[model samples]
Target: MKTYLPQIERRILVRPNQTFGILNYDMDNAYPQRMLELVAQSPTAKDCWNKRAKFIAGNGFEEQTLGKQVINSKGLTMAKLLKAIATDKALFSGFGIHVNYNANFKISSVNYVKFEDIRMGDTDSPETAGKFALYSDWGRKTWKNIMRNKITFLDSYNPDEQIIKEQVITAGGWKNYKGQLYYFNPEVDDYPLIEADSVWEDFETEAGIKIFNNREVTTGFLPSTMLFMQSRREEADNSTDIGSGINTPSQLEKDLGTFQGAKSAQKIIVIEYEDESAKPEFQPYAIQNNDKLFESTERSVEARIIKGFSVPKELINAEKASGLSNGSEKKEAIREFNDNTSPDRMELAEVLEELFSHYCSNINPTNNWKIIPVPANVADDVIGVKAGAAINQLLQSSVPTESKIATLMYAYGFKQAEAEAMCTP
Candidate 1:
């Protein structure tokens, strides 16, 4: 007999694909694809991912021209590209940007490439290999399909003018040349793990819980049962009698199915037997505990998913905390989250700065090229504080210096240091 042990198989395994001349992202070469499907299925994961992306992208670039400059013929602007890169980084911890060069060897335009569509070529050193494979469907194992036209090999992004000129000449012109891809891996890994990878199993579990609940509701929480019917002979119209046997199991199944589902609930079933001692038996399985099927698991999984994304629950759900101080709590959470992710924002800014400075000529590289952070509402901090009225009252009243400082620190949203400095002398 074959024995089975309950366990989950590891999902990540990097291996080289000799036939395709590339390295598989994971065992199946579809890690990003699998993660995308998981996020789509889990509501909490999807929400947390979106929150991270939004926070990472922020409002836009500090330079207004960056937002207005169209990077591609499709009218895609730099702002949109940054947002796309942010989304990819949020999910996969890496992103790809396709750079197109003009006839003069200057970069003409750049576009965002889906991270899942890219695979590193099989090489000892990917940075110097200068080769990458791009395909639309990696999950379908397109490498084995033998369709040479589907897999497009792109040259790695090289800012060297001489190198670009040589590529242009080799292709007979810029028109026939396939564009270069700038694959940015923020983390130092062969393929960077997704940001919420630690909670990926939880995502699947949460999705399973949802499916279980949906099934339970659809079936009206009915308990599964087994029905055993004894076979009996029946006389035929010609007075011929068949050997002891009930209707065929398949036939009985068809009859039983009619009484299944929520619509057939409380319906009665009748069975016939030749002997009273050989009557049919109906055995119901143990009843499910609907009160606590997965309540705790669902909450813990949701919390872990949000935590994995590093987003404050208050930011994800505005109605989570309700009170007079809820606004202040949310505002602080936003500030804290933005501060925590500043390094991530700076990394994206540096990548963009490097790309635009070295390749494009239209934009001024010397300018302050940085992503503008999401603006926090100052009003949120003063949720219950009547700032203007209170300030007027304080100014007009003859309050002591210590009391005034305390009021400023507590009600006017001033730091203790600032309040003490203002009260000094």
Candidate 2:
């Protein structure tokens, strides 16, 4: 048996406006860069902000930790603290990783730092320039930097405070820190530390707009309208006019109060009019259509948010697809699981892999382990139905053996070459 590695063109520069023009084709001409700049300038989406924050904060870090229990330098457990950091990262656009070490110079604990607390300096300087700097205060107003993986405090520290209080300088990266402090940000090219834009930003804006519409529909500020009274009397009509129509503001108020009281008590009231000829009518206000539209729009927005998170709509109690039979609904659920839920779980798995790897390297140097997410299982009935249909099609169709073999191979998750080999007579 021989092992073969696929030949890949690893250095294919897909980005526009490369410095080496010889290797670059000016097709789009920096359009990608302009688009990125636009995205960076876009405002944070407030409508979906809380929902996204809660999702990331609560569920993102839940049940994701591996190996030994992680406790931060401040004695706070990573399981709880990571949720806060994740929430902040989703709300803001970035976060910081602080490395802590024990007395033996080995890693003890790692913690998360808020985006606002840490600052980067001399980002343009190369790795060899020795001028790159990272600063953080952690809210105690004592700023410090990491030197050679060890936290080094600045000279401006109060000597009295340092002596009186055991000043612990916890920086972004410790002197012995070897693993990466940043994750999920590959766009920070040529810079020591640059925060990447949040992935949920666009969705947030859309969701916010929908929410605003829903709020307006639900709590609309409708203006009060006056009921007009038409008189048939001539210019000399000074006769005491007591009619069914409300003649004054006081009378209108009294009538309204009486009506409200009766309605609240679930009672019926009959008013005797002095003048039977005078008519009382109301200016019509219809809200049934508007209410229905708002409800539909809100449902659509909720569906979009669920789709954006790549979760099953059923999980959120969203309306199921209309006009689908029971069997079709089951099939759709399986498809949703395979397409969205499984992929999202897999991405989280990769993040956990990196996280565990970083922790293991520091705490137990020899412990090299990785965690894999369990894939969502599709229902056996759905699988069997689809497989039976495919087999029936293959038997009845006039397609060649190679085509049938290729189709069967695809259904069974075999490679193209392997399928062709199996089909060869």
In order, what is each prediction's RMSD in angstroms?
Answer: 11.0, 17.5
The regions of model 1 sitting more than 4 angstroms off are 1-11, 124-128, 141-146, 232-281, 287-293, 358-366, 378-425
lDDT by residue (331-382, candidate 2, tens digit) is: 5554554443333334434554445453425443444322222222422345
- Global Cα lDDT for candidate 2: 0.41
Residue 63 in model 1: lDDT? 76
Number of clashing residue pairs in every model? 0, 6
Question: Which residue pairs in candidate 2 collide?
Answer: 148-175, 149-174, 149-175, 149-176, 150-174, 150-175
lDDT of 1 at 45: 96
| The candidate that achieves the highest lDDT relative to the unseen native structure | 1
TM-score, prediction 2: 0.39
Candidate 1 lDDT tens digits, 273-370: 66877876889988667557589888889999999998888887655443335578788888988897788799899888778775557675446778
Task: Score every model by TM-score.
Answer: 0.75, 0.39
